[model samples]
Target: MESFNAGDVAEKIMAAIQKEYKELKTLNVMVLGKTGVGKSTLINNMFSEKLADTGIGKPVTDKIRKIEKPDFPLAIYDTPGLELGGQNVVNALLADVTEEIKKGISSGDIGKMIHCIWYCISTPSHRFEQTEVDFLKAFLNQTSLINVPVIVVLTQSYSKADARSLTAEIEKENLPIVKVVPVLAEDYEIDEEYVAKAFGLDTLSEIINNVIPEAVKKTFIAVQCANLEIKKRRAQAIVATAAITAAATGAIPIPFSDAALLVPEQITMIGSITAVFGIRLEKGTIYAILSATIGTAGTTILGRTVVSNLLKLIPVAGSVAGGIISGATAAALTAALGEAYITILARVVKGEMNVKDISTAKGKKEIARIFKDLLKIKRDNNGTAIESEIETSADNTNSFEIND
Candidate 1:
């Protein structure tokens, strides 16, 4: 009957978070585009940080530069000298690029290898040059055995009609590329009177998620901030797994006071979800979450008073008998906590909530409200929360250019 201490649990969760971050392998993406194709804009918005500006880069080769940040698990290999100047330029750049790819392949470490390649084309240019097409063709044939996924990205595609036309043209080439995604990474002022809203980044993020190596999918999920839905899906999966684990841990009807036994599973779940969101949670933030959702500092989560409070929110916990907790009750509690945490994080991602304010009273009250609402929801047979997903429609318009 050990007391569940919020302070101790917060420390453990913090350590778990560090461990999760440290374990994430580096996700390497090569971005190929001529200058002013909005490659910098694309890189800046695709990730959590302004990586193109802040990342320390050095020449990987004459034309290629590798950009990476300290302690960040992503690398962007950029081609600053790339342009369809002529066949000679394309062949020289191609030799440098293929050699670099071969070096990555020979490294024998998946993390060091290029997981994906992005060929960016500026939509305003309207026509893809023959040199560019020839380069891709030769590069694909040379690296055919390596199997890295190459995606053609049409940048500044504020005009959907132009994007569609460009897409059709790229598709006509019948290149063995993954997808030609048209993306407007950020809003563009079509004129003083109107601004084109950002679109297709979420679609680009989803496409990359579908193609990257399984080993680096978690890394991609952690690094990319273009799609909130991608992060939500991965975080929800972690919650589902943790909920089932909690159910297993409580199979023998543990005494209410010893429910701290569930802490380990929940901590892992929290750490993993934090990684997926790529948000660093301060100790105060963790304490605020536990205090609001689990219990206060006076009576930690498993205390008789706290358990009773939880039971009040969760009417299905009527099966608890003589201070014993059932597997279902444990799972429900776990799921509610996780879902509430995700809500808070999603708000932060959307910029609706500030991270520093999470420890404020208003934030705590909001967290408590979410947790209670989730607690009242029914669970499925597998102990996962029974909730309906809200779906939204987006045109995943992918455009490629074919330049003769």
Candidate 2:
């Protein structure tokens, strides 16, 4: 019999996950503002990438362009800042936007349709000029006809007073805007004397999250960089789902030799968590991590030695022992693996850990250690001895069969 290569299994699982991720629909957002209102900067900060620097975007229309990151499921529709004084320019821009949105809607690709709009105004300006307000009012009214939600974003607000005043003014106007969000998208230095801190980014993210439809929430959670809590929540949810799946798989009476069938779900769960954290792993790196994990300490969960030894015992005893490795064990093991990976990724994101080291031997050992500790914790909390559970379940099954 050939020994199972954990690396090969890992590769297959990652490939399945990547394929599924690629099939998800993209989330489309449109950003509107004057050129200097820091639209590009806001986008870069919020998404953790300088998208405009990539130069990968193509012109969607004369006045609009779409910026997309490779292998990412979010796209930004960027519009040139409206010329407040130029009625003709504003009209032309509006015409183009309306046409593009209608085109997307007509094609029945709602995913391609712009789900939300961010109208940015710099806070340092202190107040909106009359022309700017007029322009915004007109734009909001026009877009409302198309049933698109518009969020008024006050950007670069160095002081709370200014942001509050601006928001109040907009609210007083009773414009058709869906929400008014004040955000300091990036930290700013104003000389040796003072530096402005980044704030309200999470609020902006929450607003966006609430506005977008449910279908694209995962994409939003994955793409936006402002809210670590959102990513953590999504990761935890993935772990929970994976744990449940592992438990379900454990309920089946598969021999240890056929345990490869349990791998795909775990892989998919890990892939989903990584996607949420914006970590992309190469195939070779993934294989190395999987091999290292199994080689280091995964034997406890995978039960290779135990299975082999149990198989040498009497048939009924061996079967009963095998049955003891139940769904609870699978759930505990999977949850531990997921949480360990999440911790590692969080550290990487926070600059405390090096991403390049993740596939290294030392890194894999640390991960394996964390996994084992977490697994032990989970098992202890559950308070079920593997042998006792399996024996009880097996005996119950036998008794039911005898009675029948």
State TM-scores per candidate: 0.93, 0.83
Worst 10 residues of 2 by lDDT: 395-404
Instruction: Please give the CA lDDT of all the candidate structures.
Output: 0.82, 0.69
Per-residue alpha-carbon lDDT of candidate 1 for residues 301-327, written as tens digits (9 for 90 to 100): 556555666666664576557667677
Which residue pairs clash within candidate 1? 167-399
lDDT, candidate 2, 93-132, per-residue tens: 8778778777767788868878888989988888878877
Clashes of each: 1, 1
Candidate 1: where is the Cα deviation over 4 Å?
A: 252-261, 387-404
Per-model root-mean-square deviation over C-alphas: 8.8, 8.7
Candidate with the greatest TM-score versus the true structure: 1
